[model samples]
Target: MKQLLVFIRKEFYHVFRDRRTLLILFGLPTAQILLFGFALSSEVKNINLAVVDFAHDQATQHIIGKLQASRYFHLQQAPLSYAAMETAFRQGKIKAALVFPANFSADLGHTGRGQLQIVADGSDPNTASTITTYLTAIVGDYQRQLNQAAGALPFQIVPETRLLYNPEMNGSLNFIPGVLALVLMIVCTTLTSVSIVREKERGTMEVLLVSPFRPLLVLIAKAVPYLVLSLLDFTLILLLSVFVLDVEIRGSVMLLYGVSTVFIVACLSLGLLISNVTASQQVAMLVSMMGMMLPTLLFTGFMFPLENLPGPLRLIPNLLPSHWYYLVVKAVMLKGLGFGAVWRETLILLGMSVALLGISLRNFNIRLA
Candidate 1:
């Protein structure tokens, strides 16, 4: 027990003594949380909307008034023509354009119907979809109110939307889990890889291997401390996400921890594999950044939606552990799903961990051989 405590203490000393490792362990979580919470959000607010009202009538004025009243859109410019609207959008001054035809009021008054063209920049499809929905809802509500006043329709088509899990649909709630997975991967994998390769670079790995302690035991001792630290980091992130950002975990906390544990193991095993294969710390760092970090960021649906990606790019997420982790996070945090709901993802992570461990162990044996 004393020896184990001493080993753990040594691990802590090594971690604290190196400023870079300490920064990666502690600083990264805080920075990532702040970044995701503030900078990275899917919810669009105050979107610049250009309006071209050729109608020049009360009906068009009313519609524009309603649009400006809604907080989702900010009326930026009143362009005269479609060309001007297109130019404004191209220049990135506006995200969407509202065009009211010249005969809007006359047609609506005489024929009970008119057309309003909404041209949205489809470059960011998600934002475009959201803005379109908001505009439709507002216009529909206004139409319904007008119909009610005229007693033309007995029944109304009220939008009955039941948002599953996350009723508020806060993007932070959706992002927190992914960020947690990413931060843990970066810390655990990078730390383990660097630590192992540092020993190799310092010519101490051979000395340690030749010592009385078993190699596997030494590996376990080195890794166990990091496992504990990763858990600590996970807990801190979870707490901050919930209390600070108002992100809730609708599913069981135990389930989240369980899934996260498997993912962490897989990530750490990958680091071990890299550490065993690479001869220097620089190589390990480069390999991890190129092989793990880039793939995880691009394919895991962290910054971009998987659905928006092309077919070939979509398949890439299947190869990454972070993709599965992101799904688990979304299910638990946003969908409020139980174990049964995320069983497939959990199994995938488990399988990945087992496979990585097996590969890492084989490589360790090869190194010994």
Candidate 2:
């Protein structure tokens, strides 16, 4: 018990003494939470829109008034020609353009139909899709109101929408869990790798090796402190996501924590393997940045859709622990799934932890011999 306490104390000292590691462990999580919550949002707001109104009628003016008042779109340009609309979009001044055909109100009044073309910049598919949906709903609602005022039209199509799981479509609920996984990877893996290599650089690892403690014991001693710290950081992140960001965990909290624990173990083991392979602190830092951090960020479907990535790039996430963690987090947080829903991911994380531990042990023994 005394030896364990001493080991833990030493580990804490190492962790706290380095300002960079401490900041990455605690500061980075909060930064990422705020960034993804506010700055990096998929929700569209204040989008600039252009109008090419060939039909300068009272009805068209009324429709444009409703659009400008709705607050989702801003009427940035009222172009006289399609060429002007094209120029505005090409200059990145507007996201969408609405064109009202000539004699729009005359056609609607006589034949009960009119043509309105909406041309969107398809370069950003997400923004375009959202804008399209919003426009459709607004137009449909306006048409229904007009019909009701005109004594009930013969044609009526009622559309009922039911959003599954995330009824509110809160992006934070999806984003927070992914950010948690990413921050934990940086904290556990990069920091651990650097800490272990620091020991080698300072000539402390050799001294510890000469002691009676086994290599496995030393490894555990180093990792256990980080595990505790990670759990504490996890709780902080969870609380911030819930109370501050208004993100909810639909599944059992205990189950989420259990899966998170498995993921942290896997990440820490990978860090340990990295520590064993690298000889110096600089090499460890470089390897952690290049080998683990880049792959974890790019391939984990955090910022970009995995399906949109090329085949070769898609295969890269298969080898990353963050990819598995993202799946588990999405299941628990967004889908309200339990252990049964994410058993495969949990097993993959466990298998990865075991494999990394085995490799680290083999390397440690070889170095000892």
Candidate 3:
């Protein structure tokens, strides 16, 4: 019994001595709680909405005021024409737009009937559906209030909804892009992160460093195989998504692959950086999987509505490469957008690839202790 107690004490000392183990014990739980509490929420808020009130009357203004006052949306002055509104949707300026006819108040007062056009960006069918539901409720509430004020009159404001990009509101279309991001991150980052670390475990890394090949070539050689493999994995995922899931790619296939290739590179570079910093294969694997998986899941915006996150928490997703990749895929595969639509996200992924690769190369030690 005394010997067993001594052994337990020794184990505790070893755990506290290792910073990584200590972190895994205490820090991991704390971080998970904070991330899940703050970021993982289905209750939507701060939807980017545009209001076009051609009527510009007292009634229209009151409804607009209520929309902005609610926690659900932040309102913008909508574009003048339908074409401009379409441009706004494509540019991701507004998630949904409410268009009121010029004779809105006049019709509601005299005839107790008016039409409202609710246009939503439907690439993300879930968010689009939620936005439409919220708008319907708000309009219904206003209609009920008007009826009460007018006494026995049924004052109705009807909302006519149109969903752009995905009129059908397919559920699979919403998640496929996110699944792509998660799969690529796992295959590319987790696998590549352990490549160099495995060499250290087997004591073969020193031989590669001393050989005729340059350090850069050695790193490239380690990454090239995974890069090709990740692309193949992406292609396979795309095929299954199209045939099995019935969510077809709407944009150029070449462009989709082009952007996916960039994202894979970014993920690979991140993995290489992990391999460079970590001392052991086990540590590398843990960091690459646990450290990365949470961010990928939370920050990618596929798992939950990012707008629901608090202001400071919202900025964290922009740091994740998967988030950009998800956006690009949605624009290309789901929205049928061209290179012009996804160029910004593509550039961001490319920049992340460059930066991560550069840092990995800089920190890579030629002389390992």
Residue 274: error of model 1 in Å? 1.4
For 197-248, candidate 2 gives per-residue lDDT tens digits of 8888898888888987767778888899989989888998998888888877
Q: Tell me the lDDT of model 1 at 141.
A: 67
Candidate whose TM-score is highest: 2
Candidate structures ordered by lDDT, highest first:
1, 2, 3
Name the candidate that leads on lDDT: 1
- Number of backbone collisions per candidate, in order? 0, 0, 0
lDDT by residue for model 3 (21-128), tens? 445434443343334334443445689998887999988988898798777788877789888888888999999999999999899878767788898989989888
The sequence of per-residue lDDT tens digits that candidate 1 reaches over residues 261-314 is: 899899889889889889899999888878888788778886778899977877
TM-score, every prediction: 0.81, 0.83, 0.57
RMSD of 1: 4.0
Between prediction 1 and prediction 3, the one with superior lDDT is 1
